[model samples]
Target: MEEIWFAINDIPMDVLSRLPVKTLLGLKCVSKDWHRLISERSFIRHQLKRAEPVSGFFFQERFQWCDDDIKAISYIPVKMEGSEVQHSVFNFLPESVVLSAVSNGLICCRSCFPSPQPVIYVCNPLNKEWVTFPWSTPDKRSSLGLAFDPFKDPIDKSTDFKVVTIHQTASDMEVEDEDKDSYLTFDIYSSKTRTWHRSREMCHCHHSLFKNKGIFVGGALYWLTDGDQILMFDVQNELSWLVTVPIPLVQFDSIPEMCIGESEGKLHYVLISEGGLHVWVLEDYLDFTWELKYSISLDEMEKENTEFLCNIQQRVESRMAVDTTPWMDPLAFKDSLLFMRVAARIYLFNFETRKLEELCTLSMLGPNSIISPIVLPYSMSLIPLG
Candidate 1:
């Protein structure tokens, strides 16, 4: 009976669809014929459709300089049964390298430089495969953001990813201007084409917030703009569109800057307040209706230093000090784990249990380190590909 099943060239589509992704992947090694059948794009897409999503944490190690010599350390989270495991350390990158983003198991790093023109490298730290993405123009100043399409169609599987760069262009005036109109030019680097294409469309705002605002949702990148609108850049279509967000009838000072994140397969925006944080869910992206859901008060932070928590610079610098720091950021995750970044520590707020636990503290070198740490929407704990 088993031989009869193996003898068939065309297996039932329904059976193939129902097989677990891991089982389907394992069957590829049974034989050459089986390998070819299981490796088909159609089969892979079906498997992805039924596959479950897992979360992983993305961690970075900081090094201190002693006698003009830099020494580094690594850290990892140990998931034990009950006790909070101390995170393990790993290998360190070059002295001047800074992590920009992590997507689909790839860690994107850029060589830190005084100027924006720098070398960008992406690597699968687990697999040890690294790829270098060169800049389009050597002298141009640009800021890069990396992302991958989770819902990408398997039929068009390509390892090539997307990099959005905001470049500084030559203006009509003599001196540089901070105004939005003077600062123009946006370019996209496609790994598949191995080239850069200039985008003529103007960005809706001058705020640098959108540089890291691109959040992955349904295989597309979503961002919030300074023009009081939500923008999405479709990877498949290579086009951008704006989505309206319902703004409350509050005073200008009452409206705080909004941040984008994902939760439970839906897109969410977090409104940071002096007193606490309020989370709003977008039921329909097209309709632009926002419903208030969870509201966390500052009084529940467990810490008394309200002034220090509000200072962004001080909060970042503190997180850079030690390996086991407590901090929190409004990051998107499948589970209701509110990862908050306090001074130098990260705390996990479990919505289901209504509890807050110290996750880990980030370690930094001497107080003179020049790099500013960046937080992406996704975490390494939520995505194990790192």
Candidate 2:
């Protein structure tokens, strides 16, 4: 039976690469040659080229009560065709987890709370696999970012990634007049060498809070600086630069409801203001050019927005008043949809249809629990972190 099946199932490499990672792993046990074929490095590269499309989003949800805490991580698909669905939770992550960053398919997490020392972890939410890196020394409060581009380095074909901790750049520093030349330093951990290295000092107001606003594209990570410019980091070279920010509309709020995300391999800047939302795409990184995409009026969105706010208000205790501000945050950018997050609900806005649908909700959290949610665009991969 094995011989007959092998003869009939000699599939092409492209076809084999398109199979889900779970299926590919299972098929490895079918036969010896099958196992060898799947294990080849060249084969894995092809698999990444034809990687399974992103099916949904992975989020870190915190459910906190007066005395108890539950850190739940879950994945929610963009579409809901079933009767009712819930998030796929993974219990491997540590309690009181803070999801720092996500790139490619790996999620960067850190354990927070109570302890003076915190440990960082990288995980693939798809396969529910995780790797904990060594923290050579105890760390104070710092922001971290992850960078991964398997095909970035032309000289080396091997897949690797790095975790960057902007440990030295503090938002508020009391620099004495005599020490103005001293700057903040960066610490990086390379997966290739499986070690950490402290690099050169950066002379800028890093305001590492930019860490939360990071978006990776074309071998680099870009973060919004305090509205005046953008902080760009070259992950491979471990260097940083500043680029002037393109303010799409002058009427944009002081701190507009905005987000930076990538779509179709290009960086897009979006902000909501004066009942209108607009988008700007970074045309050329070197030239620092930006082209406007669209400025949409909220006239069509009022109904959907109202419904969404009402939905959440109905669930929350009447005593817990909802924010009366008319606003929604752009969480992510996809081909056909925009992820708009408000309160504890995430809604998918269809660009073509101009309609809003609740993508996912943090309902399982206790009635008394204070919820904090972080939703990120996720695409699962088969790459090994070892």
Candidate 3:
């Protein structure tokens, strides 16, 4: 009976869909026929649905004050209990590689020094499998982002994953005084082809000017422009569209910076002020209508006198306060975990329960170290840790 099953030319699709992805991959090693069946795009996708789901967040810590000049990588299991938070270090990153973005169990890094030619590296920290792609242009300072779409065209019968690079021309010090026609261009890199292609025209007003930052959602990338308009770059079709985001009642000139993040699987925009944090939910991406969801201010917190505060006061008295404005970058974590950094400390604000929790304090590891954490599975996965 086993020999007869092994010799069969075809297997039932229904049966194949029921097996786990690892089991299917193991069976592919049995024979060339099994390999063809398991590797087929359709069968691989079916098996993927049966695979174990990965945890939500992989928290990493970097010591910017350390003299060794090395950054460490680590993982934080998702939905960890308050007492289970661990500080496990993974490995040291080589001097040439700098961490760029994290997505779908993959962490993307790039070379440190600027060159006419650049190469981007993608690695799975869990598996340690790395792939490097050549980025030929050097005059353009580029930002890298990772995106995954199950519905995109299958590559070799497998779902497609993309690495997008937003390329902008280097600014010229001399041209700032004379040239007004300076503009930036964008290009995208595909993992399937291992090549770069010019993206279709994006919103000229937004993409060309403020193209440095964007948020990934539903296989498309979104960015904010000078006028508070949201611009989207569709990964599948390589086209661009504009979305309207509702503005607050505050004066336009008072809003200093605009950043995009994901919460509860929906796109949200964060507005920062010396007063506190304001979060707006996007009801419709196409129309850009936003509803004010949450707001937190530091005025209510009790203040304590500290050496750092005294130092800041000294600087302010000396007319050096221009360099010390209090600003923060807000991040949305899974389970409605909203985080923001305040002078080496991390604050977590819960949206569902309307509670504020200070997670941990961060100390400077060095002058160059940076921390960026993003929420995962933005759709149907925004719950607080149990």
lDDT of each candidate versus the true structure: 0.51, 0.62, 0.51
Number of clashing pairs, model 2? Answer: 0
lDDT of 1 by residue, 1-386 (tens): 67686566556545765675446557667778767756555554555455343233443333333212122322223232353422222243433455555554456666654435566676655434567767676432345556665455233454557776655444554655665354434577777777878776554444333423456666556665555667765555566656665664143333244456667656777654443566777787667778877776655543544433465433333443224332344443334555454556555556556566555554432242222223443333111122
Models sorted by lDDT, best on top: 2, 1, 3
C-alpha RMSD (angstroms) for model 1:
7.7
Residue 357 lDDT in model 1?
A: 55
Which stretches of candidate 2 lie above 4 Å from their native place? 1-10, 19-41, 61-70, 83-88, 93-96, 136-140, 153-159, 168-184, 201-203, 206-212, 248-250, 253-255, 302-326, 334-336, 352-355, 362-372
Write one digit per residue (lDDT tens) for candidate 3, span 324-347: 433454544433555555456545
Ten-residue region with minimum lDDT total, candidate 3: 377-386
Instruction: Encode model 2's per-residue lDDT on 1-386: one tens digit a residue.
Output: 75466457646566788887667889889888877877676677677766455566656544433422235555667666673334444565655566677777778877754445667788776556678876655454456778877666321355567888765444445754543443445688887799998877474653334413457777777776444566667777777776665764344433345667777777877765544567778888777888877667655456556776543322222212223322355766655467766666667776667778886554643332123345567776666554
lDDT for model 2, on a 0 to 1 scale? 0.62
Estimate the TM-score for candidate 2. Answer: 0.76
Q: Give the count of colliding residue pairs in each prediction.
A: 38, 0, 12
